[model samples]
Target: MKTSIYATLAAVAFALPAMAQDMGDAANGEKEFRKCKACHMIQSPDGTDVVKGGKVGPNLYGIVGRKAGSQEGFKYSDALVKLGEAGEVWTTEDLAGYITDPNKYVEEKVGDPSLKTKMTFKMAKNQADVVAFLAQHSPDAGAASAGDAAEKPATN
Candidate 1:
């Protein structure tokens, strides 16, 4: 019994770092976000600038837990609306895929090739990092949600 318990504890200890890496490093993500700042900004609801950038994309303050296409005052593409309708609550994995290729991700999820996003740039790499950064800014992303959500029950 003692051996089994030790093994389990050891496994969990090693797993924690791997899990955090899989979810992407939030610190690295912050640096990677400079690539996204040209179009997107992460600002608090109180109007504090998290990462001040252009207004081309909607504010991404709470996007990780936010419903897709639902950022206030921003008109979403039909495909994004469809994505939200399809029940996409942003996860880091999904968001990483999205930053890599918005149109393709949308098409894959919403199944509409014709609908395109105003976001034209496709990030060639570091998508996980950028997503991790975004996740941190999402206040609504609690214990049961966002980048670290997978680790929640495991840690408990």
Candidate 2:
């Protein structure tokens, strides 16, 4: 019985790191976001600049929990609009995938190979980090909060 208990404890210990990895490191993401400043910016609703950047892309203030291709005053590709219409809500997992490869992610989510996005820059690494930065600034990211997480029952 002791041996079985030890094995279970070891398994749980190892699993904890994996779970943390899924959450991403917001601090590291902020640093990595420097590269994205060439095209994107994180401006708040009050017009405060969270990250003063180029306006080539849409503002990413509340990217988390937001609908895809729904940025106001920004014209998105047909594919992105279709994604929004298809009910593509931005989750942390999906945002990581999208930043890794926008075209591929959209194609996978929308199921259209011919579709393309204006975002051509694909992050080779640290995709999770960048996503975490966006989530940090996302005030409406209710699921991203630790309080909300604490309220949820842990699942194996």
Candidate 3:
């Protein structure tokens, strides 16, 4: 019993870092988003353009917490749609990993080795930053508290 308890504790400790990624600097993410401009854009529901760019990819407004492949009319690959159907909701950590390697991420999620994404570009270095920027624009951060809602004014 003692050995098992120790092993469990050790496993939990090691897993903490992978579970809780450090929050990236949203300001830096804004700067890093320039690279994403070639294929994506951030346009709000009210037709306000946050970052005007190409439309090769889906509009990234409110992508955080959104169901994978849920962007209406975007025509995501079947693997992505299946992943979403399997209850994959986008979290900041998952988004960071996905942006680092889309095909790999989708493959891992869908448990299919042959799956690929239309996204060819990868943001390897500033992935966390870009995710942070996207989170800022996410109107429906699924895990956020009412106090954390964007409509609420920051206290500090």
Against the true structure, whose lDDT is highest?
2
* Per-residue lDDT of candidate 2, residues 1-156 (tens digit): 999999999999999778756677777888999989999999999999999999889999988878999999998999899989989888777888988899999889889999999998989898887887787788656654435532321210
Leading candidate by TM-score: 1
Q: Can you tell me which runs of candidate 3 are displaced by over 4 Å?
A: 1-21, 142-156
Worst 10 residues of 2 by lDDT: 147-156
Residue-wise lDDT of candidate 1 within 1-156, one digit each (tens)?
A: 999999999999999888777767777878888877888899999999999998888899878777889998998888888999999888666787888989999999988899898888898987777777776777656632633443441211
lDDT (CA) for every model shown? 0.79, 0.82, 0.79
**Ranked candidates, highest TM-score first:** 1, 2, 3
By lDDT, rank the candidates, best first: 2, 1, 3
**Window of ten residues with lowest summed lDDT in model 1:** 147-156
| TM-score winner, 1 or 2 | 1
- Estimated TM-score for each candidate: 0.83, 0.81, 0.78
The list of candidate 2 runs beyond 4 A from truth reads 1-18, 143-156
Model 1, TM vs. native: 0.83
Model 3 is weakest, by summed lDDT over 10 consecutive residues, at 147-156
